[model samples]
Target: MDTQTLKHLNEAQREALEVAEASRETEWTSPSFVAELFMGKIRTNLIFPYPEQSPEDRQIGDEFMKQLESFLKCNLDPDEVDRTGILPPEIIEGLTRLGCWGMKIPKEYGGLGLSQINYNRAIALVASYCGSTAVWLSAHQSIGVPQPLKLFGTAEQKKKYFPKFAQGAISAFALTEPDVGSDPAKMTCVAVPSADRKTWTINGTKLWCTNGLIADVLVVMAQTPSKIVHGKEKKQITAFIVEKGTPGIQYPHRCDFMGIRAIQNGVIEFKNVVVPAENILWGEGLGLKLALITLNTGRLTLPAACGGMSKQALRISRLWGKEREQWGAPIAQHEAGAVKLSHMAANVFAMEAMTYYASALVDRGGSDIRLEAAMAKLFCSEAAWKIIDDLVQLRGGRGFETASSLRQRGEKGYAVERMMRDSRINRIIEGTTEIQHLFIAREALDYHMKLVGAFINSQSSFSEKWKSFWKCAFFYPKWYLGLWCSFDWMKSYAGYRPLSSEIRFVGKNSKKLSRTIFHLLLKFGPKLESHQMVLARVVEIGTELFAMACSCSKAISLIRNNPSDLSPVELAKIFCKQSQIRIQHYYDALKKNTDPEDRTLSKKVMNQAFSWMEQGIIPDDGAGFQKNSETTVPLEEKRRYSV
Candidate 1:
């Protein structure tokens, strides 16, 4: 965005964008499949083979999953855990005994050294049975100390902490505070350096720190002292490793949530908590980047877990669809129920294809998967939620009943209601759905930002602007013209005969999608980001295109080996047609929508013009809501928490 347009934003929006811009991975050192899609290019080679898990790796994961399935079947009672809001000690011990704690740690550290594919398989298996248990294991390593320590730690740091995870030590990530939800720029948590620079003192309250209540170690983010460079001051956020017995660390209360009832999430308070400088995982000014990088990979776990849950929903829906009759016939035979059932099956197939493909990319390494991972998280989470919602509707009243209640009435409980409650959190964690849209949009624009920023940036000198304007003038006409009419004869998907139509749609519409973004950018200029709905539509279109391509790629791979069963290809056809319908709807909305009217109405609504509209409803003022005293620290004291 240009400087003049930035001036139109409120202080909070400006600060958040500024901090996020500073920490962004500005260089695309490696090629990204999704990023290229935004650039009007499709590298079919990347997705064509649909990278498969090696035979040995598959055997290893299969053996581990078998053991995990036996353990969960024998010991886990998910309904009981949800009712009690506590995971049993014996279950945690059993997981540790099975080496779940060391699943992500490298074998050099005497840990499991599981590949990303294997780890995701294990997570998916666990999640199929219990949501709380999945969170318990994933939270310990996905975004926890082990992840950062392995990614950014010194050799000595890894040597010190890796062994602990293998020995059943739990860990947590502390970044979000009471006031700061998604933006770390507003973070008031501070770590102050000692006079000798040998120790750092941290003080702040971290809210919703998953696994914090019982974690043996923590990776805490805090603002350090700022530095002046090039006539500007830059904020510094640092990551630290704090141990369990740290004197000033306290968890005074645990948080109760709508779902995942057995999680050990709580408020963690740090008061003058001091640690040696060596505890810094990366460097003083690189904490936000570290967290973002860690999450780029950690986000994979959620989609796989979501796939697991989606599979379970499919199973329950299938059994109920046949067993329950309505209108004098099996529900599965009814038009509405039949449509949902077919789409549910098709969606599950695509969900597995997209997530497992991304996981395989991670295991393969050196591919820029930022866009791919974010899209996987966004697509799979939303798709899984929709699948579960359909399951509930299919089950009718039984879906809303608790499993225990159903069992008490002498009926077999499928746990649809519990799954719905548990699945809602996926859209909120890692990053919210709205936040992911913004993140994807920002990265999608980055390629153009680098190419033409000097031309459009208000901060640029007239001489520089003149050169950039002429550069774009010479470059874009040819580039923009190709997006409209260019045809690549050599770009035909060779091995994708069964699903060639879907592949062709993605290949063709990807260019149209990029062209649409170009026109929108031209129309809105630097103020385009403020037009969020328009950008969201563009993102959804691109996401659908990615899904269709993955589905086609995986279908080809599956049918090649079987040679007889083309069920996977048939699933791909259903999923791709579904995605095409969605894409067209998005395109239609992009051309015509009530955006201007919406802005005006939203302003009036927030200004209390609609207060009269709510006169019939019971009056509620939120006074009954309990505010935590621990987070309501005084302002003067909050400064004491800052650097």
Candidate 2:
């Protein structure tokens, strides 16, 4: 089945199809289940299987979660557990014992050595109770110390560090400073080499260092002067492992934050600190590369926290909407409330599906999953924020009160605020959204170029979408011209307002004209390279749309193969519809370029690209969802395991 045919299915039919395909061990409450429903039958059937693990790994993951959940039950809820914002030592010790700190470490080092998929499952569990807790745990797992060892550390470094580090030894990632962010090349921190290159001295201040107050180890990046080959003088930034109490390392009291307050975020002043020469990560100048790789790894793990938060937000809204009614019936039964709930559901489901896909890709050893990770982080963070915002709205005044679950606290709002800020940072970190687009466009263009070359060289004609797209190229000029005019009109209206009674607008200002202009701008408007920022946004939306489509398809296939396993596919289908409509809006928006010039070119280029995508796009030859060894809690198992 094609995209359109699947789009035509009723919600009930889609749900039924998904229910028939899921495994018996997966959870109904999971975003994975919802993701399946979101994809439906046709798309799912088309994109059936991606290889990675067997059902055994999934089982291990589930069992681990169950054990961890039982351990966390008493600690997670009940009583106001130190909301005064101290990183409790007890919690740290508990996490260490659970192997949370050593997940990425090799199995030989006493770490669980779990894959990215299982690690994210652990993160989701932590996030469900407290996003703050997840943040604290992440500081140790992602940034602290173990990461550098895995990515850039020497074999000896791993042997010396991974064993002890895996035992929950706290560590700090000292990078951010008072004046530096986003741009590390501009950092002023310096590390001058000693006479023999045997020991190096460091001096710099690192601000916003999580776990700094109690960490036993530190990964510090600084500038080092290296002799340039054929050049007079040179300096490069490098990273080093600084043991705690290394002379000159000092920690200021932890900095307070808007959210995730329980996590320790502090300032570390490296006043003439000293470290061994052999401690450098992949030698000098590779610090940036090491940082980027570690971040990519962290990005894979970030989405699960957001997924958990989104789930929590949905639960909050549902409970409040049902109990707090304006009319005789529950507010959830009302149209306005229903719309809000639907939107929240859609966002969460889409985020979850995308996260799952990204994790799966990473687990399968796909190296270029950075863009996917970024997309997951961006979408999931935004979705969680929206859900929380709506949940707050649903509670009206009560949600604003500090007495609500930590999810509704003023700081909870900040957790989202920071999450958004942090999420945006990632968008620009590994690659900006603009950069991702450039990467995507380049990939798309390459694929198309190959197709055209094949056709030109072999005289072969592609079928369906490709042929139709090639045909649409002739209509480019008309579309491009329309976009230019629409933009001109929009620019003209910027200074004018309809809110004022005296304001006057010109050039056929009716609903029809508005739509005509909008339609034209939607397609060709995004073609303006001069407005690269806007173009970046347009592409970002497009990427989300495409990714959502793929995710929905994947989920649907999973559900179809194991219906009893994915009962929640019914809910997922609703969310899938939501993603489709949202994506369509962007597509429709791109279609409305009133500028004639852009309309012309965009039509031709878009058609050309469409043809290429179709010819090159390989559909999943329905092997159905392979029974992977993913440790999942199917509805029946959860029911049986219920204490």
Candidate 3:
């Protein structure tokens, strides 16, 4: 969109863009345009920041969990749990009683109307207790029912359907058919309209429907017509509310899954099932958008549950590592075991932080976040897989064998296997990882171009001069290429050189000399984490850095003077340092691959950290570290207070 930004492309960026535009020829799995520009590398220097939630939000999330724990303790009869599958009927009833299904439903519709933050916290708790139960709850409220209503349902539709969700009445979303899995465009579930256009006859089988076997209401997507319109084919997609006992609706029995077995998943054949026109959600042609919205929300939320599951596995691994000694000291003290623990901690923390950040953004309701959500989903899901694998390895022989009935080998194995299967589904479901890359590339390019265009537009007085400079600058193509290549190269090279360069730029261009304080903060970020203050300051620095970058681009548009003006340049310099410090803090908090002691401490602490997580304790809280007499907050509650 911004042509001036286009002019800023270094050679590597251009090359990457070229490669990405040609990605289809390479099975659409090549390195992304952004990757190519940044030398096919990721900058570990940049940290994604977790939401700086207010006390009210934290209290809300915490209080919600306290309520859950209370409900689980008071209402749920532990004896009702199926020891084999361990999915308690009382747990379901308790969730139903707690109004869990009404979490995201609007208050106007008789729901608690919790925000995204509350929803994630609840899901994490469920996932930690029982991954299957978590899946069951999330799959129903998240993917199965209210989502479609949110996207396509009319005001009347919302009024009618949303109220039912508060009752915890189960529903299933049917999209993946027997013949088609990821490709909804290829779906053959046809809903033919009646002669009077008042009703539609649905005919098709929906495969892999979670809660499909017993759902009281089903929201099914069907393709009614496919024909070319305005030189583009119009694919008529429609959704209908098919009650469980609809005349032509037939369940083909439960399709047993490897994991999440307690929650029934099955296929349903719609043999000329008849439904009223009033049931058509938001009318024809809106089904796909509704489905996409539902899927994207699920893609983002599912990973949060995965993060919890991974957290549980990591905790179990560390617990075993500490208790299960072999040869000499605890096996966890062994180097190999320690490495596994460290890697797991790093991944768990990163995924947790990332998921929260993404969720917060979604809650903010400003940014499109399609790309952000997809990236978070991709990273979090993949991280969960690796974390679980390492957990299994850390457990050794006992981990492989069935232990307690609650944590039996068959159940754990099936759950893990199911998670793996479901994990792959996320990659392909909303938009494949490859498709995500395309979106990421487009967004990055769009961002870059916007900056460039601003740079050009704001320089109206010197436009001719800049044009002349550019013409001569491009004459030496190699030099221009090298300039672009530098951005790519810097991504892979994590040394202080890039920071130093930014520092130099700031020092030269900064208007107020005091701005250098921010630059100094950025310079010490990596070192500070290496120091004892790894948990707090680093997060601040990462946040500063991201804020600085974003602010600098904004300043360029807002400021009148050009970069050539010393005052303008100085202002930009000051902003850059402030922003960089903020941005760098995010990465600093990532539970990184740090010193041996920090890593060890992080694992032990995070284990206890997780225990109190649903209770609202953060990782830096004292459960991982020793009690400090000097601090006002108890060691157990330091992280909770810090936020």
Taking all chains together, each candidate's TM-score versus the true structure is 0.96, 0.67, 0.62
- The candidate with the higher lDDT, 2 or 3, is 2
lDDT of 1 by residue, 9-112 (tens): 78778778878888888888988888999988888888988999999999989998899899989998999998899899999999999999999999999788
Task: Kindly state the number of residue pairs that clash in model 1.
Answer: 0
lDDT of candidate 2 over 1-643, digit per residue (tens) = 1112233446544333222211011222312211222111112222234233468878878888887788777666312332567545676687778887787788988998887788888888777666567776777777768877887789988888898878877777777777666445456788988999898899888888877877888788887875564453334668898888888878766787656666677888889888999989888766655665576667766678878776877887787788776869888888988999988876776676677766776666523554456567666665666777677667666655554354564433323333332223233433444544543332322222322333232223466446545644554445435434544333343222211111111121221222332343344332322344444444454445444444444555556567676633544556645654664565465556444676577898877855665576656778975666576668798899889
* Ordered list by TM-score, greatest first: 1, 2, 3
In model 2, the runs with Cα more than 4 Å from the true position are 1-53, 77-82, 226-235, 404-532, 564-573, 584-643
lDDT, residue 63, candidate 3: 86
What lDDT score is found at residue 207 in candidate 3?
87
TM-score pick, better of 2 and 3: 2
lDDT of 3 by residue, 360-414 (tens): 6566654444444555666666667777777657666545443344355344332
Candidate 2 structure lDDT: 0.60
Q: What is the lDDT of residue 637 in candidate 1?
A: 95
Decide which is better by lDDT, 1 or 3.
Answer: 1
lDDT of 2 at 206: 85
